[model samples]
Target chain A: MSKSNNVYKDAFNRCLRLLDETKSLPSEPELGTLLGVSRTTVRSILARMEETGLIDWNKRNKTVLRAPRSEDFFPEEETDSLAEIIERSFMRRLLAGGAEAGMQINELELAREIGVGTTSVREFLIRFSRFGLIEKRRNSHWVLKGFTRAFALELTEIREIFELRSAAAFAALPEDSAVWADLDRLELEHRQLASEIATRFNEFSELDERFHRLIHRASHNRFIVDFYDVIAMIFHYHYQWNKAEERQRNEVAIQEHLAYIAALKSRDPGKVDAACRKHLKSARQTLLTSIPEGRQMQPA
Target chain B: MSKSNNVYKDAFNRCLRLLDETKSLPSEPELGTLLGVSRTTVRSILARMEETGLIDWNKRNKTVLRAPRSEDFFPEEETDSLAEIIERSFMRRLLAGGAEAGMQINELELAREIGVGTTSVREFLIRFSRFGLIEKRRNSHWVLKGFTRAFALELTEIREIFELRSAAAFAALPEDSAVWADLDRLELEHRQLASEIATRFNEFSELDERFHRLIHRASHNRFIVDFYDVIAMIFHYHYQWNKAEERQRNEVAIQEHLAYIAALKSRDPGKVDAACRKHLKSARQTLLTSIPEGRQMQPA
Candidate 1:
């Protein structure tokens, strides 16, 4: 890897962890402290956010922190990259949830803490807020809203719903050029995500999330993504059970993910549908195993 | 109604509308404007909140917003009333989104146009954020995170997970235990909600969401309620399509809701499950009807 690439990866991980820890925006000093990066390097990264065009900050100034409020971050150039945005969005929320309580975090503070900049923190924050987990205050400190039981239940239900939704997207794929290209792109993402999970030793919960997200994106129905996000949320929240409960199921997941990619590569929709179901089932089992007294039928 | 009670209810709706309008915490002036009451009257409401200890206000005697980090506003006692919170939270998100987009708004905002001063909104925000839809900002403005795709998927999946969750809760109820007592308590609330929807009902999408929430509360599980909330978000985001695209399914949903209460009081678990599933299926079908275009096979 190039030296710059290695540095960027390190910066990215630092940002994710800081978000998890603080659930707020981090400032420049905090980023420098966390990533061991100079402010200059951090600012450069923030500047490159022009690619996503998500955050707002004076290009010449160093201190103002702002978020994208419908200013061209909508992905109009529009490749099948919504999946990537979704994936990135999920990571931001996870990190935000894990943020430490009562830590006075600001956009700059978050940027510093996460080794990014005020800009990315603002962009990520806007996206995170869009998902309704992180709320910004009048004074600019981050607070955690946490999840409701209803939301959790709704999220779990999405896995079931996605099966139906993916069926729709799958059917549409043959006739819709956008849908076909979306799957092909997602297949590549799944490969990269899978490789990171297997070879690079990624976080299991995140890897699992990305895997399913790949399926969701392939479904290619806009609502399919929003609609299925909660299921992913349920799975993510109960991820405490992932490594501990699904010890044996890791092998199953590997095969499921691979099967999905192979099918997508082959443009075999049947295989995609079947493999996705199997993957979701395995994911469900992992969640079930984590709960004491697994699910059973009783005449209510 | 007693004058105080009428006043309280009126104030409550005002706050609710404010919550319906803004996702951010309201300033004192905003709250007064939303309530249509003098700033003094709003202060009285805030004082009552502070006195009851349900909310801790900013100690500085400013507009008496929610205490920055107090757990009191979202007391554990109210967790079981999950549906109430879920409804308010969605309303709050809708309000905020509408406000942001500058469209489809009523003149009177809910309570403070910042803080709904309603327990449900607070609880819902906390819970939903935990699940990743609602997030807190640095300045403590509650940001309405977009979980449309994820949330819609959750609503569908939840209809299945909750049947099990509710069934488990029902089984846990001892035959002589006051499950009926709980129902009796919920009866009035349910009727009030149903009547409100039935009377002025215009939008199928909103009515559909309202029905699911009523049933979620009726099931009486805080944990399950939270799960249902995640699902409700799914409904909120996707019900638009389900209503607009699948008119027949919408009609079916209207008919099902027509008798939902009777089915619950029938006191048969299977009946309730069947009813709930049937109700959910109609709604699901409405949503799913649009999904098959991309599906790989004919949906069974």
Candidate 2:
């Protein structure tokens, strides 16, 4: 659910930057490549822009569409939701290649990079400041904060409970709802991903997120959705903590996801519960192993 | 968990305003009455204030030893978490006596009234703006958004599922955990509240929040806790729609909570689940009746 929004925020930010610097809007594939996101994300941003009169986008004319006016530059008021935009930018910074704990984030630099006003960035910084994920200095700069191993352990336990409940809910969902169709598609995708794990192990993170998101949506609860966004932001994006075993762990996770899907499809509550617990336990172990001997445990 | 934070936010905001205007700290009772919160809230705020160098205190000097410096006014940095502070003020106004849907909320006025910077409020507003609970005008003012019956119905369904999961988790918690002690205290409080329902019906709202909060804590998931904050804000506070039946409904709710606590103390998951569903069903009904004939259903 949230991954799609992150794509939009990243794509739109890239578009804004490109428009400012190069005075041109890139094609969908070009924007996707430039932003390192997905073409679907690029399309969503462009579609939203067209809806809001930010651009005159059409399938026949994909290039330019004319530059957005000054009045169209307020990012929070258009395209993605504010939480999505904020989380996307924050996760990107947190998961960026070569990113380190305790890195200082320049507010102005972030505002420019994300193509939002400094005030919008400031608003998000203040929101995240509550979580100790970032702290505003007396000089007004923000510093990235590190999580302790204990934080991760505690987080894993909580995530287990949430996922278990979500799995049970998914199994119990009426077969007639549109959710079943989505789950069918996701299950097929899961099988395909598991089959190609040797070649496409890196794609597991996105698939893992979507697989759990399907179960989460079955509950139709906004609270779970919102809270899962935080969980997804941390676990899905924080894989950079240990890149050495990424492929191996992802291969194991795909197998677990496949079994989990099989159990869910059976519509047996106990089976689904057991499957969720097994996969989540594997996930917890993988998460713990990814953190190197508490080197990242320094308090923020 | 989040309720305690809300208390601090409300109390600290009041104290900051008082110190600025009067140059003197108010006594606990005075502050409580002035802010329309509780003495516990006032004390928590003062304790945090003392810890943060916003004040000085001891058995001998129970009052502020010195006024805070001008730099101490950055609210999100001091006293309470930003989310709590924002939600507390927003819930208060939305559920305030005689407050109506579609009421125009002046940003400057709310900032002054809450004793927080307009920026803090704006940040919070933007977050809630995503939910359509509030809206930002081109002129920068905001308006209170009304929810339809369909919205409430959908929300109630989701809340039911979340609470059901929470109740089961609570029942499964080990007896050795500190949550057991808290549940004992709340159980006794529930009985006491039930005994005085005729005259103390108003107090049920507070007790109801605490009762559910204790179960919510048993899960110990920050996501559940955070999600429950939204639930508590909506259900606990949004009870002013049908004041005429308030006392009668509260009486019924008190009985339900008593049964819920009894079932929980039994350590039987089945009993606990049944009790939770019963109480939550009553809560859902009460919520539906409170909305006055679709008077507040205009989409924001």
Candidate 3:
């Protein structure tokens, strides 16, 4: 709104961009000097970032927890929008405590707790309503819907079809396409994640989404791109349902991803299909185990 | 709602079901005796059915024009649901006159013409809003969006991938699955359509949807099933955009469908893939041609 405000916003964005290169933040005095801002202005921006869980500011230093994602690029505000903030908060809540079937979600309480307008929450809820993930009650409240094993199996079957097609298409893509360069970078990332699987296994979910989406994009099909959203939402969020074997599963998955990446690099249709199916089998098993035993059904 | 109303409703449902077996309705006096209702009740029900385009009652005979579909199973009224009726009406309008991008849609005027409340129309509009097919304007009005050639080509590419995977899966399915029965029935229908293609070319769209959906369902993938709705909606509705070559395209599509069916029946993965791709190529061509030439673009 003012020249000083613009200066701080730009600095905050620069700091977020820097997280992509380094996990540690510079000291407050050093950052203020680098950003050409006063220490007080730097502190205000850090506090906003801390509030949204983007970074952790300790007595001694600040650490990057998560980098700014495309969805976080808000022009009007230097911080996350109310929509994005609410979504992250709800996801964290769902992961911490599993939802029960037909569990009623109090809309008013959620709005009050998030300190966002009820209208925003209602619109968010309505958007998800189309996915059968949540249902709006007659009284204007919402109820959570739990996925059955059958549902996951059905989704996995579709995901396999989608990925196999995408993998084949990726292998067939021209060598000059930009996706080849991205594949190289993703392969390096997969290898890096594999090396640290013992400590950072939880980060595999985000990497897995990125890897599959990269392959899917090679097809250049809008339908697959749009539908992949549903697949990603369900698989990524529901990964929190059963965390007992998460580390072991993540290790296996990382290895599978390496195989998948190698197959794509080979650019052989037969080999790509084999590798894609192999990785999908592991994914299916992990998805099955992720569902609670009582809720799990026999493999469809 | 009343005894007489219930009787008339039952008779109307019975008449609709009977259309599956016969294309002609019995005389009113004979229908009254068969339904065990007075001639007056039969006449009232017939009038309602006629109003909904389910039948054509003339001076001497009543002919079954179209059978009742699931969307038309509204009990309290013989007509289609407000949502579907309005959707059909708007689609017809858009097809007859192409939608220009950013053309503002008056919600109140549409609701008035469709004999439905604004809320119903708004809900319907919101569902399609996610696809970028329509947009809710800042002033609470709506605007129409048109598909570019790139959009159709992208859809066709994804459709090809989906059907190819589905066909392969269908070929590998156990011989005892219910899909085999549907395939058998669909094959017969395809043959029937093929035999009469010269006269009944316009009916191919319905059968094409059924044939593709059967293959898609064989994979038992919920995401594919859900995403297929968008694919079907765009390809099916936009077919009306250019009717110049409609008959020829339908004839070719019918023939391709038959070959695709035979490939599936052979249970050979190679054959299935070849046949599926062949049909999809033709479908892509038809889709490209269906868009006005001025709107067509080089395939990505």
Candidate 4:
């Protein structure tokens, strides 16, 4: 198949939510601006809505027939782009075992197995190569450098370095900088999550990423900001595959984040460093413990 | 054309040097092993050598007829892989001016200009995106982020962080570690280049990369190791574009590197940090100064 219609599908899902607040859809141009798509894409969205009897469209008029049901929205999986699909498939194979170090990755075979073209597979591999889990060979296929303890250690090593520097930078931000406001909001979220830990602990992963990302952004360095993608990807998969003790792990993390946030608010580098170090140390341990026993390398 | 015959051309050049050492060519398998190519490639190299009158071959025996001349080797440009060619072409466009931030990059237009397939251009963009100099728009083309002062500052910020950590790690490595030996070798090269600074200052860029990379490798973190690519790319162009006081600047840098190397050998974290920071600060200043005046941003 060609590139997935994820843009349209995802936009269509968001448009359905907008319909609940009004009887008639706004003008096409307004809707186009609201949905952040071109006029052509907006028209396609309207056509799909009309076909499903969710709206009545005429050149400039679109009337919502009723509230959209759950079925009206595209499946969550279908809304993901082809690159995301390939990455998920590839990562699953990587974390599911049998993907050993130095194993050759065949581009054509992976494309066929994923039911996508080789170009898409090749592009995905190129993009994913940044995570350091796979490598391209000269005049040959890619290689799988297994997700071993060494990989985790190396990842956290950089994460700690970056996050610490970012945290210090965050603390040094002027009082009026917008990041202070963002820190306030995240602090509140951490408290809420901590209070509702029994039921909302699973949600900490997303909040955790946002909190760290906010701190990383304060460094005002694109490389530091971009480096988060690697940390986020590893944690994304780490959270998915290693679910054991996740709630407890997240609970402890929430408290650490609260302290970390408070330390940043204090605008003292020492407190920020200590708070960031404490949280990162625990995080490094959590990641280290998740690596499979067989793949764990002895510490140097 | 498909992938350039770079692998063959480069291997052929290396083979020429080997032919000078021996009167007769080695067995095909032995030649393949030595050149790090397959037997097929080895045979092809032999065929080219014989056809060019550099060697006489008959069944099991192949004898060198005459020393290979300069004309026997492929042009230096012809030996660069398609990706390298495309990157050089693209970076030239980026650094040559008129590449404003927020400008859309047309893959087809770039491919046409570079005389390569769109696939190669697309792959290059995907790979280059990690450098944060360009961004991919959803369902559209890549956007040039421009090589502005902001970009330079952001780059050097991470460079300082990673290098400082790496230097400390280098100092901490046990005496038996192979990296200490590597560091010693680089130190000797640095001294050799320093003594010949008048004629060899131009070569300092390559040695600078090697010395820093050796320190980075000690971090044993692939992310830290791989990050040197961004630093190298920017400096590679910076050295080419900004040549004012070139010899003097490299002379000072050579001295800084010597001091840094001495600190690493001393194996003291305090000394290492001081030496690394001193060198990195000068490097950062050099990079910041190289960014065009128009693209430089006021300090926030």
Candidate 5:
């Protein structure tokens, strides 16, 4: 698969949603604009729709035949880009608890396992190495540094430093800065999530990332903004690996976020600092508790 | 062409320095231990030395023939790893004033230009992306973010944050920690360089990196420790690009480092904070001034 055809597949899925809202498709150029794709892609989608009898195509006219059924849509996994596929596979192995520190990671083996080219595996490793979980050995393979307690501590340590500074910066943003409105939006989401925490707890992982990322962006420092990737990855995996008490944990976190948002809105650095620290401290604890005791020992 | 033979060439260069002080080569095992290579590599070194008449080799015995000439060593460029060579080449283009912000970087073109495999070039870009000077566009090429004023400011902002925290951590380290000895050794080197500032100012760039890196390591956070790479790269290229007041600037930086070192020794947080801020402020100013005014405009 050259480039995975994810762009076409994902766009086709989105185009199905559009079909449900209209009697007939718009002009090819207009549909291309709406789908954020090229004319070629739009034509391809129309061709596929006509072939599947989902639409009747007669020059300049595309009439919907029926609403797209669940079976009519492409499989959910087919729409993921190759990089995302590789990342999900790689992270699964890493967080699966069998990965040991100092284990050599073979690009060839990973490529074979993932059914992708070596170049893609190599590129994925290079990109993933920034998380500090894997490192390239000189003239050799990459080494797994393991997701140990020390790794969690190191990650949270930087996260706290960055988030604390960013929180203060967020509080100091000018009244007219667009981020205040963003904070308000996030604040509303936090409230909504808090009310439905019992059922919607799983969704907090993503919201947590966006909320912290917004504050980090306030620093207007690319490095600070970029460092969120590390925190996000760890939490993304942590949330998946340790599901026990997740609902309660997320519920408490939602409340903390509301407080944190209120502090940012108050534009009081002291309150922001306190709220941010309170939330981060609990987050660090949650991450630390998730690592298995056996894996927590320092690597020899 | 395969793996660059840099490990062997660089090791051979170090072996020559060892040969200069010894009459006969040590046992192959001993030589391997000292050179941090396998016996296979040690044998290759012996074979090359014997072929070049730099040594006389007999079974189980090898003797130095004459002092290794300058030509006996590999070319300085040949001793660099492929990644280093690619980075230098890439940065030269980036800092050469022709690389516009938002310009696309083609890996295949870069590989051909640098006379390396595309894999190496791709890997270098992935590693370099963490510095925030470049970003990978979805499903396409990497885009140059440029070394503009915003880049410098953002870099120094995190550098200051990380370094201050690390400096405080360094001061709080127990007396038994190994960093105290390292600091003393660096201080001695700083003093030596200070005395020879007129002639040795160029060397301060390397020392500056080591000094700051030592402090960064004290944080015991890999993210903080790894972040020094960004600061180091910017300064490495910045030092090469800006030549005005090089000697005087290094002289002042050396004094600031000494004061910073002294404050760390005193374990006075207030003094350390003041010294670190003072040095960083000047350092930031120096970096900001180096970017040509024309390149500092925000990308439209």
Candidate 6:
């Protein structure tokens, strides 16, 4: 929440959008001026952008302008952001220590919105539906179904332990080829996802989901993944809930995501972990601040 | 497995089981003699154990030993050894992408052997039932479910992605008083879970689940946890088939878990992340190697 970090985020998002628009990487200084931030932050952001393969990390000359083709940005294994949103909402309770939150979303629209073919959306739906996040109803229309507020608190508790385990596991990575490669890939994925900003909250939700899951998957621990998944499902919230941010906050969020991307690209596990905690802490603060006159943060 | 590592593991387990026999800790020479390993391996294992809080890693003016008392060895809120068997099964999949062929188990008898509460048994049944790993008819008898060879391989892909997200969020944690204490407590829980030896495949699987869940629960990232949950539920393996050696690998698992615990105690994020990947890799390799002649790892 520092003023400095905020400027970095703004400049970062501006560049991402600009890249998407121009289909070319712009001069680093250009983004800095456009976002009303310093050139230094912009340069670091650009550096991070390059590290993640979102743009090639430039070399030799100072005035690097050619950005990666927009086409290359979209990976072949695209995810459904909407499905991810709904599923994430459903899981919020699980992680928070609440019962499942269920909802059926429009697969076709959700897929289109996330910029993926419908194939992946259907698969996502099927995956969560079995777990009761999506349900078949008499109306024949997909509808959202579950919510348990306790999940949020439980999830907080679980994430604490997760960090501890990660702290343990990260340092202990075997000095072997595959394990080594996985560490690199995990760091790389973090860099890439942090740079791109989804047009909508739902889409961003999915990207973020894959982003974290990629880290866990790279560790290659199914029990860790599955256990995480269960608590997550138990704590899931609906897509409707992530709607309270002020416009300024939302803008700030895009930059934070970008900064996170930059941190990951640095390939310092300590930094990524720090960024991850910072991100979660902000949300926790937001939730804390948002509590109303009669509302408190406790199991509902 | 390396001969030295196995030798160290055997010695560690012997020391672990002898908790009631000793008033305090053992010395390095004593440990070396106990397991017939060289003095050097004992020193290394003891150092790692100290880091994990399995022992007090004080500056040894004369020697290394002094494994902590039982209460110091584990937290009050953790799952027991038998439950750990089941839980660690998940750990293997979460990190390593492997599931050894488990043998048909009598749920009731297995429950009694491990001394876990019956509720845990039922929870396992429910989980295994969903994956079709176990079948419980109307009469209430649990039967081993049929499985194909491809189950472990396919599960690895999904599990890997799950941990990646976890790692990202965990790496994000910051050193602030607001939530740092909670983070420390969770870390302690992870250390306890990470350091265990599975006596049975079924128990290992249970422990694996608990260990990873402990981490996910601590992560507090709804998006990361929920997405992982839905996908994890779809991925399951029956422990009804296994060779003697793979099952025996548990002999060394305790020491490995202890190493992870040590990393967490140090709060070094890089080491922790590496530790997680290393642990999971072991699990994945186990499953990869444990596939029976006719088995096919499941495809998501």
User: In terms of TM-score, which candidate is strongest?
Assistant: 4
Please write out the lDDT profile of model 4 over residues B96-213, one tens digit for every residue: 6677898999999999999999999999999999989899877778898888888887888788888888888889999999987888898899889989988988999999888888
Docking class of 4: high
Cα lDDT, all candidates: 0.50, 0.69, 0.74, 0.87, 0.88, 0.50
Q: What are the RMSDs of all candidates, in order? A: 16.3, 11.0, 11.4, 3.2, 3.1, 24.5
Q: lDDT-based ranking, best first? A: 5, 4, 3, 2, 6, 1
Write one digit per residue (lDDT tens) for candidate 3, span B144-179.
765666667666766776677788989999989889
Off by more than 4 A, model 1:
A1-172, A185-208, A217-251, A260-274, A287-300, B1-177, B184-214, B217-224, B227-258, B267-300
Candidate 3 chain A weakest ten by summed lDDT: A1-10
Model 1: DockQ vs. true structure: 0.06
Task: Write down the worst ten-residue block by lDDT for model 1 chain B.
Answer: B99-108
Q: Once model 6 is optimally superposed onto the true structure by TM-score, how far is the C-alpha of residue A232 displaced, in angstroms? A: 8.2
DockQ comparisons of all candidates to the true complex = 0.06, 0.15, 0.26, 0.85, 0.80, 0.03
Write out the backbone clash pairs for model 5.
Answer: none
How high is the lDDT of residue A147 in model 2? 59
Question: Against the hidden true structure, what lDDT does model 1 obtain?
Answer: 0.50
Ten-residue stretch with the least lDDT total in model 6 chain A:
A72-81
- Candidate rank order under DockQ: 4, 5, 3, 2, 1, 6
**Residue-by-residue lDDT tens digits, candidate 2, A140-231:** 37777555565577577656766777788788887787877887798788778777877887887888888788787665555455546666
lDDT of 1 at A295: 28
lDDT of 3 at A38: 77
True contacts kept of 2: 0.08
Error of 3 at A199 (Å): 5.1
Best candidate, DockQ: 4
lDDT of 2 by residue, B118-189 (tens): 776787776565443666654236776565465577567656766777888888887797888888898888
